[model samples]
Target chain A: LAKTTQPISMDSYEGQEVNITCSHNNIATNDYITWYQQFPSQGPRFIIQGYKTKVTNEVASLFIPADRKSSTLSLPRVSLSDTAVYYCLVVPHSSASKIIFGSGTRLSIRP
Target chain B: GAGVSQSPRYKVAKRGQDVALRCDPISGHVSLFWYQQALGQGPEFLTYFQNEAQLDKSGLPSDRFFAERPEGSVSTLKIQRTQQEDSAVYLCASSLGAGQVNTEAFFGQGTRLTVV
Candidate 1:
């Protein structure tokens, strides 16, 4: 299992782009970077996932460096509703054993 | 249902009581997982099942916690002799399979368990 480290909390103004990075120094070769967002009283929703380079989706974008040791999740023009706890996970494609989550970054969007 | 569903969205149990949370996976999903989330912490993995077989359970905190997925669709997580530390949100998720593609897991709203 690859452990991820992210900021405990962040505050950003509305209409501003927010970028949160996650560090996985011991990431495995087969690991894929995945991000999820969780609102209060709800389960985590998938934001974006990527293996390397950049991957964009309707909600967020995931960027992974060539070394595969770090990844970033970017949300554009965020609104107050985007305020939630975001988690970054490194999952090995071939591993069926377990998937773990870090403390996660609590993003607060202020208007 | 259209997605994963968990029963008794909120449960309050007395200390030392036994509680059971149910999870109904999406139709035909092969991978089911359970996670426990504290107040301000990220979700911690509890157990996982591939079909009817429990492939991983090392994440279970103790023997008091047991999960079963009979028939490979619905799952139940039972915690006996619950303690105050067992208070948390129990989340259930299901995915198509553990393959590279479609590895994303669809999660249910989760069951909030409070032990008093």
Candidate 2:
């Protein structure tokens, strides 16, 4: 399992782009970087996933460097509803691999 | 149903009692997972099922916690002799294919278990 480290919390203004970075110094070769957003009283939802370079989706963008040790999640023009806890996970390419969630970064969007 | 559904959105159990949580995954999903989430922390994996076979259960905290997915659709997580430490939100998730794929796992709202 690959352990991820991220900021505990972050505050940003509305209509601004926010980028959250996660560090996985011991990432495995077969691991894929994935990001999820979780709100209070609800389960985490997938935002974006990538193996290397950059992957973009409607909700967020995931960028992974060649070293694969770290990744960044970018949210464009964040709104108040975008406030939630963001988790960065490194999942291996195995049939029965387990997903370990760390203490996620709480993102707060303000007006 | 449409997405992953967990019954009894909220549950309050007393100490020494047994509680059973239910999870109904998507119609054709192949992977189902159970997780325990504390108030200020991310979800911790409890168990996993690939169809009717339980492939991984190492994340279960103690012997009191048991989960089964008979017939390969719905799953039940039963905790015997519940303790106060067992009070947390139990989450259920399902994915279309096996864990090797990059598919997204759809999660339910979860059952908030409060042991008093």
**Which candidate has the highest DockQ of all?**
2
Misplaced by over 4 Å in model 2 are none
The C-alpha stretches of model 1 lying farther than 4 A from their native spots are B99-101
A5-59 per-residue lDDT for model 2 (tens digits): 9999999999999999999999988899888899999999988888999999889
TM-scores for candidates 1 onward, in order: 0.97, 0.99
DockQ of 2: 0.83
Docking class of 2: high
Q: Report how far residue A22 has shifted in candidate 2, in Å.
A: 0.2
Backbone clash count, each prediction separately: 0, 0
lDDT of each: 0.90, 0.94
Give model 1's clash tally: 0
TM-score for the first chain in candidate 1 comes to 0.96
